[model samples]
Target: MQANYVFRVTVQLDPPTAHLDPDRFETVCRLPAATPGTDGWLFFQYNLWRGDIADADHMQSLLMEKLGVEVIEASFSELETDSAYRAALESEIETDLSRFNADSVDAVVHQHLGSSIHVRDAEAIPDA
Candidate 1:
């Protein structure tokens, strides 16, 4: 069965030094967060999947493949799917309901990264 999931992913990476762009960092890595915190760590949120979700390791790899940056630290936390949460998500991200249908972690991440806020994973509450 497919279900909506919230994934909070953080990655540390070095700039594309070999790209020949004058903006590349010499040695230090870059953590580009859309909304960096005081510590400068970039945080990402995506409404992903659970049964076929991308574990930290897989996320690390995909980031490397797509962005050419190494993922140093990564973590996953589930978010609640309650109505209140859903309403908040709608207001915050305006997410497309169909994305929850992604069949793999790769698909989910590719579709939602850079577009949503930090999302956590959670077990579904049993229907009363």
Candidate 2:
């Protein structure tokens, strides 16, 4: 349940005079984990081109709506998950290997996530 896809976002003020410190700022967006074996799980493959955001206008619209600010840029960072989540995801993958067109769980994970999956110990995650 703690799994998520993290994005690094840059935002700008509508008016340059809005903030004296900086007109542009950096922020992070933690998208909830999409259930494995669902189309939502293909977010990286369908929504992103390369490691960057594929559709700038769409991303900007989404961020603007959520953050209530002008989104300057957004980039896919990584899929952060606990070991338990990873195990579950792998189990889900195993249930339908044909769906991924891959022989093994590792292949399916690599095909979708590439090197952007970060597995961490569940206990290491701090309470929010």
Candidate 3:
């Protein structure tokens, strides 16, 4: 039997700068997990920035509350069905990294399934 889950993560940038610094922004760390009676698992993607100056915890809390998403600390197992989804996520990370310059800025990518996942995090799929 397969299981599926969705991850909702909130990223907080430091200094609230005007431009994003790609070098300072490290790779996104994710904790994948599965839901009951599903075929795939959800993951958390986190981007770490240099120079601590913002409250990531506070920002995460606000985002989860505002978006009415369940936020928890857990691990997710990879699923074969998520191959395409992972590819799209990697592509977006590449794009964001490419756009990074020597500027202090912040951005967020909310990931989920279907409309729940932001386009920035998920790829565009046609109606099934």
For model 1, how does the per-residue alpha-carbon lDDT over 34-100 read when each residue is reduced to its tens digit?
A: 2212232112333133332346677667655744655564444432244544344344333443544
Error of 1 at 94 (Å): 25
Task: Give candidate 1 misplaced runs (Cα > 4 Å).
Answer: 1-10, 16-55, 66-68, 80-128
Better-scoring candidate (lDDT), 1 or 2: 2
CA deviation > 4 Å runs, candidate 2? 15-21, 35-42, 48-56, 126-128
Single out the weakest 10-residue window by summed lDDT for candidate 1: 34-43
Better of 1 and 2 by TM-score: 2
TM-scores of the candidates in the order shown: 0.25, 0.72, 0.25
Model 3 sits at a Cα RMSD from the real structure of 16.9
Q: Is 1 or 3 the stronger prediction by TM-score? A: 1
Question: How accurate locally, in lDDT, is each candidate?
Answer: 0.39, 0.75, 0.33
